[model samples]
Target: MKALLVKDNLPDFNGHAALYQMTPAHEGHEFVVASAANVPFSGPETYLFPADADGEIKSFAELDGSYRGGLSHAEALSNAGYTIG
Candidate 1:
């Protein structure tokens, strides 16, 4: 599923800042934000969360747990000192 990676004000499992994975709300699935980069988390069962396009759409695979909250995924990748695209 395509998801947006957004900065979460709260820290993650590792006690570090993290991002939120948000998707659209549907029948059984209320609009909620999940933990990005596979942090394994969801919401407190809310239905009033924003469902707009807040961040860049990325595949779940790209959120390979490499992000640890300092810089954004794209920014980190770009500043990795390598010529990666």
Candidate 2:
């Protein structure tokens, strides 16, 4: 499995006017503290991807454990027609 860390923030209204039309656009994705010492406003949050994730994944985990972010890399890979168990 792979993971991608996505920083959370308010959408930029000035640069992305079209995005504003899409209300609640920032509702997706989960965020977790990278470390115990890391504050909510500082440090990177871990975003776990499935083993079947496309392109590349930042974290790897067994299928038995709960996933942290979007679809697992493995699941994504399976959806893309790759056989991985």
lDDT top scorer = 1
Stretches of model 2 off by over 4 angstroms after superposition = 1-69
Q: Candidate 2 on 22-80: residue-level lDDT in tens?
A: 11111232221121112245442222232111213224342222223332433333332
- All candidates' lDDT scores? 0.30, 0.25
Q: Considering every candidate listed, which one attains the maximal TM-score?
A: 1
Tens digit of per-residue lDDT, candidate 1, span 1-85: 3234445443322322333342332222222223223233631211112222342223333222233444343343223221211
In model 2, where is the ten-residue run with the lowest total lDDT?
Answer: 14-23
Residue-level error in angstroms, candidate 2, position 77? 0.3
Give residue 17's lDDT in candidate 2 (0 to 100): 11
Clash count of each predicted structure:
0, 17
